[model samples]
Target: MISMDEFIEFVRGGPLGPIKKWGTKWSLWPVHLVTACCGAELAHAFACGYDGERIGALNYGIARQTNLIIVEGAITRKMAKVLRITWEQMPDPKFVIVMGACGLQGGIFWNGYHMVKPSDVVPVDFFIPGCPPTPEALLRGIRQLQFKIETGEAKTSATFPEVPLEAGRKPRVLPKSPKKISKAPAVIVNAPKEVDWEFGQKLVEEIKAKVEAKSVTITGKNRIAVKVESDYIPRAAMRLREMGFDHVKNVNVIDVPNEDKFIVEYHFSSYSVKELMPVIVNVFADIPRENPRVKSLASMFPSADYMEREMHDFFGVIFEGNPWMGRKFLLAPDAPEFPLRKDFKLEEEVYVR
Candidate 1:
């Protein structure tokens, strides 16, 4: 029903002129699809300090209701599928804000196999570059997006000389021994000193005695690994806290499809003990994949609460005692199975894109 001249003029007038002149400008709902550590800064940006809501940008968790998406950081191959799907689910004339240095080009994880560029996944409106950019910087990025949409000008285009992909470069051969290895001038050398922790060994001994596990091996100087029954994790975790191991570092659940067992580890460490310093003690167990249910030690270590939730989100391993384990998938709702597990093939997964 629309004519060509009007269509041409509308295109020239840009997105904000007719459809989003005032109401949408004052209601830029941002969909939060947090992937990495930069999510912390993003939370601050939306929170009281930065108050992104001042400009009418509300951080919404739903995809259908949001016009803008701020991808936090590091979209893994699995998360890339999620990013693409979420982008597609969003309404027409949607905008993407790729936040953090990791979102730009993988940052510290550049060489990582799992990572993918956010720009490649979606048509990015703005990029806020920092490991995890400050809340003010994130707000500035949102403002930039608003400006670009209003003006119909790409704010981030760059002109650079292109290098040939097949440019000839010689590969360096490695030396056989330390004496033969050439020392680079940029490298710094600090003299190694003896580390004598006052109560490290004593704490380890006390903690080891409390666990009824087969073996409590001190792997690194400050790291301990305990092989325990799946049923005894709660008791073991309680005892570790009594021995000054207060905080849980992480709860890692590695799925071994071939072995039909899930390797669940509770990596705990102490913050209060002076001599024990910052030691991580891992209490691990091999749980059956057929019935992947484990005793949740979240009561003993509150930090393990979200970690267990994330583990359940990725591995489908049920923590029997977790209060909120019934919620739909956190990362991948439509994923066929646990993508992080060995058997969930990328080629086999039916992505919305």
Candidate 2:
């Protein structure tokens, strides 16, 4: 039996070759596979302002019916699998156009642990380079693909002339890298310094009166650090809840492997109280890195539910009462376990000279 590539070549070599190519070129329906922030640019391209349909490419829903895949922005390790699966479901004579610098390389997240290049997972026909490429650039990429289809050859829309260097001029020298990577950087999760604030002073007094805090310090403007033992977090959370901290703004876990501890902080704020809107109280505690366990504050602040699960996924910290404990939340099933932990290193890349 002939393969899909062979069948396509036969069709192209037959009497209806021009007709097939023309039809395919003009009828490029792209399946929506938005993986990241670059989706914003893709939306602008198809929206009323750009009207990408003018070029004969319509953004469709299903993978089987579409002939093109525009991979938008950063394809995470998790999204790469989905990208491959989507490509497999597309019909024969399918093409791929990877958009943004993230799709080509890693863009801003070049050294990120979760980032995966789209090109590594799928056969990309064209790559549009930008943090997020402009709508015009995306449309131009579509045009380039269409040209490749009809003419069976790739052509650039622009050309540049080569310039010779002057006789006494030397080649440009790149400056040395300024980043000083430390093997063991001192990780100070909470070393509180005093800040002057009248409201902060009053707030600290109120917290001291209500909750049994290990230490209360005004970290910055509108920011307060309330330290407590791991066992007392739930109690502290309960007190904060009563004090009008209705929501958990953020749940953060800092892995201090050098110190053999993990700092868990739940930033709390209130939507009900207008005065508390800008105030962020960080309720933090340090737990042994080897046996990281903390009482879940989800019961007190229901908004901490997903945040706790995410922290569980990244740092392998057990939030005792959270139902999603021991289960994956934000990270993929096959992704490296406890990836955000300082001890968990990403796979190193080697560039060929």
Which numbered prediction scores highest in TM-score against the true structure?
2
lDDT tens readout by residue for model 1, 215-322: 766565666678888999899988888877888889998766666788899988778987545687788888999989998878767898888988887788999888
Q: Write the per-residue lDDT of candidate 2 for residues 32-151, one digit (tens) a residue.
A: 688778899999999999999999999999999999999887889888888999999998899999988888888878878788888889888988888889999999999999999988
lDDT of 1: 0.77
For model 1, give the 10-residue run with minimal summed lDDT.
184-193
Query: In candidate 2, how many clashes are counted?
Result: 0
**In every candidate, how many clashes are there?**
0, 0
What does candidate 2 score on TM? 0.76
Looking at model 2, the pairs that clash are none
